[model samples]
Target chain A: MGINSVTTMSPGVGAKLRRMHPLPIRIMHWVNAVAMFIMIGSGWKIYNDEVIFGWLHFPEFLTIGKWAQHGLQWHFLGMWIIFFNGLAYLTYGFATGRFRRMLLPIAWRDVVATIKDSLRLKLSHDDETKYNAVQKLLYIGVLLAGVMIVLSGMAIWKPVQFSELYFLFGDFQTARLIHFFCMAAIVGFVIVHIALAILVPKTLVAMVAGGPIVSDADQSGARHMNETGNHP
Target chain B: MSKPPSRSIFRPSGKIDSSILQADPKLLYEIDRRKVIRGAVSLGALSFLTGCNVSEVDQVQSALRAVSTWNDLAQSVIFRPNHLAPTYPESRVVKPPRFNAHYNIEDVQPVDVNGWKLELSGLIADKRPWRASDIYALPEQEMIIKHICIEGWDYIGQWSGVNLKTFLERIGADLSAKYVAFKCADDYTESLDMASALHPQTMLATKYAKELMADPFGFPLRLRTATKIGFKNAKWITALEVTNNRPQTYYEKEGFNWFSGM
Candidate 1:
């Protein structure tokens, strides 16, 4: 029952997992994912209604829900979920030292070394015991991006209500662009993260079945898991 | 897939083989300031994928415009004909009402009401010009309602004026008209759906806080509706046209959503 501890279990070797992600983290992760999905879809549909580019908008196919109102409704409802969930996640991160555990105290040398080792296929640092330098940077970067996205979203949603946030982004329109940019960036992370999950089966399994699994993540998976979000 | 470079004269890169600027007037100006015009590039790549040339500006423009218009139509369809925007009490009114305009407040011209006239046209049966006194003489009603602004501000203020719904009924305007366009003396123009014009809270506001609104506020008269954002509360009114034609609003022309609902 050493799930918290990574283990290599083969068939007939009963795998009693101790740790990977606790139930709360798993639940929050999926909740966050669902909320993000709703937000992106509704966000795109609402964007279509406004036609910001002065040209082509997101084709209807990429958007979520049926109509602009439907999108608007879902987008707004999802906003509260995202806000509260984000708050909970952030509070947990800071309160449990997971925020610090996930991010900092890395030397510049370590970052350069990580890059060199990654490219050289030498940074097989995905032990799941802790995050590597690159993983830390990406996690922190994405977290900050999430915060900005929410703030900018609020700015756009109620510019008059939250004039400071609106003005901080320069205006309603600029805040909108900032929100869209952050959304796209997070989506990009989602794609890379999913692909990494494919490469490192244990990382995926660790999240799902809990882990007492093999630690020999395929080298590419190791780099990807280390580089993406060593979500523990 | 291999592709050809665009040879459009107005393209940002000076590459004109295929591009999006041909369709949108703002694209060229937008790209000049933004180092990376994300939409154009993404569309250009998408055009390449679909084997489309950027030269089809008219079709692309029409398609995008169609979507915008469709959004308007959808909103119109969903608009509750009988629904009214919520009203607030005296205490909710924000003091020193926020002043907002496209241009700075200092530049607002004090329109001379002595000879000022409210021009009327389009579907209305009466086309005679109206005066400030004529507006003041109308049956007065007061409602302290939240004025929502698209710029993201809100305030409650008691606006007293002739109820626009009653005025329209009295004027014998074609109530079935599609849009009620307001042309401001300051050159800003905006429009509202007929349904919105008939909403119970819709008023031709003459006074703010129990006194005639100063010129900086929409003097003589301005639209005061409970539901719409601030931009819809156009000021310095000089003309009104009720018509089926989808006239372009000043902000709408500048890329704001036409049916910008709450």
Candidate 2:
């Protein structure tokens, strides 16, 4: 979603909140963060069972549940939490039109310029409420990767029941490889995400509170209101 | 907190000679401390050099293997040997049923069905070789079921065969034995739990797609079931053994799950 995504709270023209993320969004964001870490840590331990390349391991210190049995327990627990949380988040986002409105006008052409600007560390403090092209791309990429990871995970866990997904992943070991790489990419993205959050502390605070402490630039900028209001 | 005297000890300065140690108690104390420190370091090295000490790698590997063993036991408990695999409609069957083996496709040689006889051994009451005619006369059934592979693909195929449970009974096999092993002509060995061997879906498949099996399809006879992966199917059957000790299959020795019950 882009800057145009809906916040749905209309507290008159000059309200206290500056029309930032709503409370549910912030709460879900924290839940997702914790879930992701658990999944990754346990997944690394499981991967250590059969090292993919030449005895390489993620190191016992860096992983959760160094033992296979205990690691799988942690993994399954994380999987359920993430799966259900994602389901609820997706359902609410699409139903309220927040997903589309928040991520709108994200053109593919702006990608290269955004990358260049990010490399140079060039940014506008005023655009904190709005998403830059690079931020939008990263968010969208993570969302897509999340879906792929889930599907590949299911295929590996239950190949017979979900035969089509198994085939899509190009076989069992191939799916495992995809799953492992997807985890690594997401981990990298999260590190960058945290660093960026540190750079822009205001955004982090807003996410924590789920309300804009700053000013809403536009009167009717959010598309969420229109999308839901029109549906009724 | 830098002390010039402490730094001079390792520097081998002649300022602290044997006569100076007797004259000054501080120098004697410092020399004794150094002796204790050196002893500790030497003891640490000796312990490591002895080779009886446990290593970090060994501990972690054992921990993981222990967990794997626990997983195997847990999986075995949940296994429902009596459960039947779901059947599908004839229209849903996948065509050109997948050909799989440890070797290349061209390397598969054809067996002479004319002189072929299904061998029997182990705890079986009847060790006589049965000709194709004898096997064909047994009561058979047909099923259209999905066959999943360990490599991550599946295909629906029509398999016609005599029910393994019935065949085992007809051959007077020791049903209570721990394992039912298939020793294939292809040199591939596969085994199943006595319960899995008696599963309703488990069969000694005689025909595929309503036709006699050819070279690629495990001609003459094949093992068919949806309970296990494709590699465990054990094609081109030559001998069947009923044994108390479960024999590990060719793939199982390669670190694949033994039960492998999907």
Best by DockQ: 2
> Taking the candidates in order, what DockQ does each have?
0.05, 0.08
Candidate 2, clashing residue pairs? Answer: A1-A102, A1-A103, A2-A102, A2-A103, A2-A104, A5-A101, A5-A102, A18-A212, A172-B151
User: What's the TM for model 1?
Assistant: 0.51
Best by TM-score: 2
Runs of candidate 2 with Cα error greater than 4 angstroms are A1-156, A159-232, B1-69
Q: Categorize the docking of model 2.
A: incorrect
Tens-place lDDT digits, model 1, residues A139-184: 7888988999999987666543355566689755677788889988
Over A1-232, each residue of candidate 2 has an lDDT whose tens digit, in order, gives 3333333333244543334677777777889999999899988887786676766788898888746545665675677779988888888778855656556558777778877776797765565656766776788788888988998888776555455567787656788888877887798899998987899888788788754433333432332233232222
**How does candidate 1 score on lDDT?**
0.73
Q: How many pairs of residues collide in each model?
A: 21, 9
TM-scores, all models, native as reference: 0.51, 0.52
At residue B173, candidate 1 shows an lDDT of 90
- B1-262, model 1: which lDDT tens digit per residue? 8789767676676445545757777766666644467767888887766455556654433444455566566556656655655566777677667888888889999788997889988999988888889888889988887665654345668898998888887777999988899999889999899888888778899888898888888888899876567788889889988899967988766545577664
